[model samples]
Target chain A: MPGPKIGRRGALAAGLALPFIRPAIAQTAEPYVMGSLFPMSGPSAEFGEAFTRGAQVALQHIAADNLLRRPVRLQSEDSQALPQPSVVGMNKLISVDRAHWVLVSWTATSKAVAPIGDRAKTIMVNGGAVGPDLAGLSPYFWNVIALAHLEVQVMVPFLVRQRNARRVALIYVDDPLGDGILGQLRGTLPRHGGELVGSFSVPRAAQQFGPVVARVRQTRPDAVYVASFGAQNAQIVKALRDNGVTQTICSYSAFGIDSLRTMPEAEGALFTSQKLDLTGAHALTSRFATDFRARFGQPPLVYHANYYNAAYLFGLLAKQVETAGGTVNGDSLRAAMLATRKFDLVGGEGEFDEQGNMLTQMQVNEIRGQQFVAIG
Target chain B: MTAFLLNLATLAAISGILASTLNFIVGYAGIFSVAHAVFFGLGAYGGAQVALLLVPDPFLACFVAALIAGGLSLCLALPALRVRGEYFVAASLGLQMVAATLFAELKPLTGGIGGLVGIPRPEIFGTVVPVLPLALAALALILFLTARLQRGAFGRTLQSIRDADSAAEALGKNVNAAKTLAVAFACAGAGVAGALYALHLSFINVESFTLDQSIQIMAMVIIGGTGTLWGPLVGAIMLLSLPAVLSFIPFIPPTEVGAVQQIIYGLAMTLLMIFRPAGLVGDQTKGRSTS
Candidate 1:
């Protein structure tokens, strides 16, 4: 049977529709994989829920808001908050799940996984782990959060100018993040005419701070900086108060853990963090809080917001790449990110340097009655 | 998929090597020492330092690691001479704890908690070797040597000492020397495994070689059947690959994966102990320890 011949007008209409149909098919390609490597099983498992929910919420937004031309899925592995496990998780994320872009947190885990990410040529976006060592860990690596170096740059001068504290004694955890902060304070303090009187490294298992407290007292500094995190901050601070060695205690945003902030020991302690107003007011943050609470039945924490920004940023970057005749992978997305350095994150507007480190306005805050209050 | 499988294989082989060497001590010599991870960490630091400061030759790294770990084995060997059975176990545990602390504090050489990161991939004659092959070859060599040693006279002497310590000594068996030699050789083998572990992971930290790691190696030896040659290999493969397999299951929630994996692994171990007390691959008649 002979097919009916199309008229000239019909033939012209079909030809014009070809371009639209081809692009529509292309836009429906297989969903890309976004991966998260976090401590989901070990001591730091508490961070896992927020990290996972944050990314999932962002993916939900990407779909609801039509943020990307194609769909994307999230795959995750447990890092156990250690380097060795992180290597294994990172391998599975890259090789098995085919995650070309990975989100990493936890300072040591981030550092450990970077080599694998580099080897696989995956774009690794770090939303947590503010270690200065991660600043340029790999060409494929970039930070969605400010490194501790930036916090130190904004903080030490504030301490010197506001409190007139010149000699700063450091009590830091014996880990990469703490080491990075210490390195920054070493250079940052000196640059501002301040001296690092003594720096004591504390292992993760340390409990009795009597020796550390005595050593810090011996340094006779005007201010003490606690570069440690979590419950240890409270212990060190309590020991300092108990010893009657009260100077303006300083730290970074890692001090925001709920346990540390609520304690009487952390009273009057100051910390520098990326400019984020915790109030549920800002447009993006408010929307995110609503979405998070709706989905996860709780308000988001600081880390959740950071990871949400990471996931949303990925979708936006992928969209931009697709619009510009590229696919979402290490090279393509990285070039797109470098080109578009200024992104409107869920918290606020964030800027990135050539090294792909997202820079934010700095805010100094104090723990006042279990709340983080901006200290001007 | 290929890279992931290769990584898994490399890890499994490293664990297998550790299990086999541990079997040589715990199974063959009846040395119930729990400080095997100390040797692993010593070797890891040794190999990592060499890779970071010098060339990343796998052979050179292995050799240096063996010497470093073997030299340190005197701590355990001397204690083994004075202690018997459970006393030696306690001494070995103390060593593991002390070694872990040292590994974390030796910042100049070990890089402290951050560890020797970015350890270049191992190379032989300026050629970058694939990690799985290197690990697999190492595993094969350890297994072969173990089989050969088991049939030799030295194996019989150790067997006699394990089954009847005082009688073997009265028979002019040079008991102390045999124990010392067994501990050193077993530790050296563990050091070799550590070298390959560092090479495979391309990073090493104090966390990787902890008391938990020693317990894991012990479990592999016990679950796989200590006296049998392929026992450790079976146990290592089971433990190392369980999580990977569980991850593939569609019904399990992503957040519940690790917890579920632990339950399954524990359940498997319990079931194995109940069903096959000698081990999955062990001969019940010969694998028992009278010492």
Candidate 2:
């Protein structure tokens, strides 16, 4: 944490040796290598695996189709979803691994890794970190997921229209992920003629939710919305029922699906998802879902959709750019990323805004029996 | 080669400070302070705030932030000191969770999950120092602190407290006061490191300082050697920098490579504990300094 100290003697000695050690470095013509870092062994390992699987698929597709014209390879690093490991992982990715592009996941790791990416001048793409302010921080960084700040704007309208909710209660983890969503809800909910009646805040990865559930039950709102992760959300749902709060509880994406597999109380929870229901045979959805199932040997989770789309988009962009006779260096690749006007993928057409937020529609679903059924 | 050295040096610098801080709590004071990340987070937030809000004199803000962090650590220590061992570890972990959540949710102050961005690097005495120099400066601070702590009577007293708090307390030493001071100093040092980390990366969030970080800090101290200065430096360089270096092997995919590295690290730690309980630079035995 302290700035690197320069001892008087050591500084002088280093100052003297600097002239001798100095040599203007020239750029080498090595093929571009990208590093994708994620939490592959810890709690976040599920998402990390999915992201890597997507990246791997994308890289394969690129190679199969000759997307970049000049063979580009990808190296994935596991930060174990922790800052120190991520920092360590990224250092290897850049200095040792020699990667040009670095992709990371989730808000926590992204926040830790972004600075490292910027310091190293590595082109960093965030597949999972969706905090709104992330885009404005560093030029080299961009996120594939929608910002948490936009959740209210994106979800409030849906909540008002689809769920027919008059009053809403908010239960969120007390961190940046929760804060961004809360900010969005505060800003957009009132505009949509809905009121956030009461709110509860819990710590991240909280195992016990009895007190938090008690706080939410006291609110007695018509609908309760929890912006939490899988395990925490599952615990909260159980607590909510135990407290006799019969309100329709909804959670933010993937929590419901991941929870039902672990916590049975998550049977009928409603949640928002960026991925559409591909259960039934539809052209784009069916192909992706079927392929994903074959590859991973299970139905694609919510985030898998984004990964699939991101990979496809990457291959598509690389091909188009290479076809245009542009090198897939940082500037050219960034231009290609920017040039993506409308990417018609599996679920919908994605139009990346100037901020690189892929403006696309999401689906709302409720767990009916054993599957996520599309609601309206 | 220079880049590799710089990377290794940077990891060592961070690890040294972290290990030193951990040593004060777990090594010297015999406390399982899990909330080490809180001080680290505070430093990061404080440093970033100082860099952004009180521009033109960010270094001044670093001290201010450290003071605030130290004060907060004292507040946390007052209640946490009541607990012992694993329970104490759990409590500290709870504190870390609570702090991180607050940092994320308290959007007005901490910038939420999107985190604070564009934190300006320090401009000490009107010179724009690059990251590597700043890294070297951090390493120097660690070295200085390590050496200073070794020579001082306060250091010996602290170690005595860790060695046997009951005996130390019986000898007319204020055990609680010593423990609290150790925690505070460790937190302050971690805070300073956090500030430097902010400057180096120019971005931060609550996610950066989680319970996992507390564990990592513990690992740095454990793997390096609790009381020695160079232990953390060695561990950090080896563990943190090794993965980065391995990422360059073209045949290994970065993701696969990362997993392999973790497996290797986990095995290394296990072997070190089983065969050499003293750790790389630790005292002769584990749990000897503290009971």
Per lDDT, the best of the predicted structures is 1
- Report the C-alpha lDDT of model 1 over A1-376, residue by residue, as the tens digit: 9999999899968755543453244345767889888777755666665677788889898999988776887777877777766777888888877786898998778878888998888988888777677788888888887777778888898989988999999999988778887888888888899999999989877878999889999989999998876557778889999988878888887775566667887788898877776564778877888888898776566678788888888988888998998767898888888888899877689888888788877788888887777775
Query: C-alpha displacement of A140 in model 2, angstroms?
Result: 4.0
Clashing pairs in 1: none
lDDT of 1 by residue, B52-82 (tens): 8999999999999999999999988999888
Q: What is the TM-score of each candidate against the true structure?
A: 0.89, 0.81
Off by over 4 Å in 2: A1-32, A115-123, A148-163, A183-194, A256-263, A275-286, B1-5, B24-35, B56-62, B65-109, B112-114, B125-127, B145-149, B152-187, B242-261, B283-291
Give the Å shift of residue B48 in candidate 2.
2.2
The DockQ values of the predictions, listed in order, are 0.28, 0.26
C-alpha lDDT (0 to 100) for residue B134 of candidate 2? 59
Candidate 1 has an lDDT of 0.83
Give the per-residue Cα lDDT of candidate 2 at A25: 21
